[model samples]
Target: MRESPIDDFWVRARAAVPTLPAAVPEAWAFGATATDADALLSLVLDGTKTGTASSLHDCEADGDALPEPGQLSVILDGSDLPRAVIMTTAVEIVPFDQVSAEHAYSEGEGDRTLGAWRAIHESFWREYSQDPRGFSADMPIVCERF
Candidate 1:
């Protein structure tokens, strides 16, 4: 038997900013860099705040479990002196429990809908069909800067 490779991916968005106050947790600084999705991925894997020297790739992924978007940001602080701020929102792509990857794909690339419910449904369903029991097409996830 062979284990099929699971492509579990999520996109995190962040607003670009310079420095965030040290009092604020690095996890919440995601809003400072919400457009750059890669930063969030780094945060997910390695969340230790390195104070200008830290990077997310440094973290260890012990298992294949996924990170909770809101929860994920809170667990880590990025490397920055006083911490360079990161405005981030995350989208995680995991192996479908029922829906196959062939069916789901991201809908909004350049188009912005101002976060209407219809827009949210379109985004999730456009990339992938609804999970019904888990993530549904009716409700949408809204990300913001911390």
Candidate 2:
């Protein structure tokens, strides 16, 4: 079996900014997918994207867990190299249909509008899922802002 990749990002990060919390990062992950991950990480590094939303159904489907406020997460690029670390500042669970415009703007996707985010995310979820029902208005979404 191939061993997982590892690096000294944590050590270097600590040296670069001494005031960061002492708590170790709780998770390491790339974005939702290769292309999306790279794009989103760019947004993050450029200080444009401050928040993200994900379908709770999708998380369950993928057997991944939700993130919580105060948890530090290492964001990685498409190549799986750690690039930046963000401490989740807030987390909320809301229905897909109920997502607010402010939250969508923080996502920094196409046009940075709620409608655009909805259209894009709806298409993404439908394509991402194997379930016959696909994306639904009432589906619970994890709205996380960091």
Candidate 3:
């Protein structure tokens, strides 16, 4: 398999942070697209956004695996360069409607409210899928905290 952009970063990071394990990272991304990825990565670097969510079905559809706790991943910037390394501290699979206000707050996006998070995330998920049925309140979401 082809190495991801994150692989290059992992090599550099391990060199810089000698304490980091030598094992390869599981995955890495810039969070969303250009603008969104920059923003989210900033939040993570500044210790603002500690939580994120994704559509479980979307991952399955894309053949991308969901993250598991204890896995280490790199956070990338808009140019697909590494900005930070994050270790998954927790993972919760829940329906969209079951997402709590606390989780929304941790995302550090919009007004930091459940309504804002829901609106933003739902819109992203909907547009992310070509199918109209991509997003729904009952959709299973993977809520990850690091």
Candidate 4:
């Protein structure tokens, strides 16, 4: 089988950061579409974005483990190529409506306000959530800081 790009990226990353774990960590893009992924990745690379949020229902539906502090991740760009590595600095679960303004600012999206974050994330989850329940104001959100 052909070697995956993530594997190659992991090898180089480990070589550069010898303190990294021996095993490869999870790799994923930011948003549902390629454009979104690339845009979000740029924010991360520029130090503008430091946090992200996800749907708890979607995580459970997908059988993905919840992120924990100190867990490393490989962030992928639009083309599914690894671009940067990040470590989870914190994780909090809260209702969509209760997400903090500080968290929203850390997300580094439009206006970096809670209102914009809610609007953007609500629209995103409504259309792209993996959970059958889709979007709801009371839905649990996984707020993560990297």
Q: Which model scores highest in lDDT? A: 4
Predicted candidate 2 versus true structure: per-residue lDDT over 1-146, tens digit per residue: 54333337766777888986665575454346878789989999999999988788777877777998887787888777888999889999999999999999999999999999999889888887645567999988899999
Cα lDDT of model 1 by residue, 31-139, tens digit: 1233423454354345331211111111122222223334323332343212233333343332223222222222222222223324433443445432333344333
- Report residue 6 deviation for candidate 2 (angstroms): 4.6
* Candidate number with greatest TM-score: 4
lDDT digits (tens) for residues 1-146 of candidate 4: 78799999998998998999989999999999999999999999999999999999999999999999999999999999999999999999999999999999999999999999999999999999999999999999999999
Question: In candidate 1, which residue ranges exceed 4 Å CA deviation?
Answer: 1-24, 28-36, 39-109, 114-132, 143-146
Model 4 residue 56 CA deviation (Å) reads: 0.4
43-137 per-residue lDDT for model 3 (tens digits): 99899999999888877777877888888887778877777899889999999999999999999999999999999988888778534469999
Measured against the true structure, the TM-scores of the candidates, in listed sequence, are 0.23, 0.86, 0.87, 0.96
Lowest summed lDDT over 10 consecutive residues: which window, candidate 2? 1-10
Off by over 4 Å in 2: 1-6, 19-31, 130-133
| lDDT on C-alpha atoms for all candidate structures | 0.29, 0.82, 0.84, 0.97
The order of the candidates by TM-score, greatest first, is 4, 3, 2, 1
Candidate 4 — what's its lDDT?
0.97
Alpha-carbon RMSD of each model = 15.6, 3.0, 2.8, 1.1
Candidate with the larger TM-score of 1 and 2: 2
Candidate 1 lDDT score relative to the true structure: 0.29
Candidate 3 stretches with Cα past 4 Å from truth are 1-8, 130-132
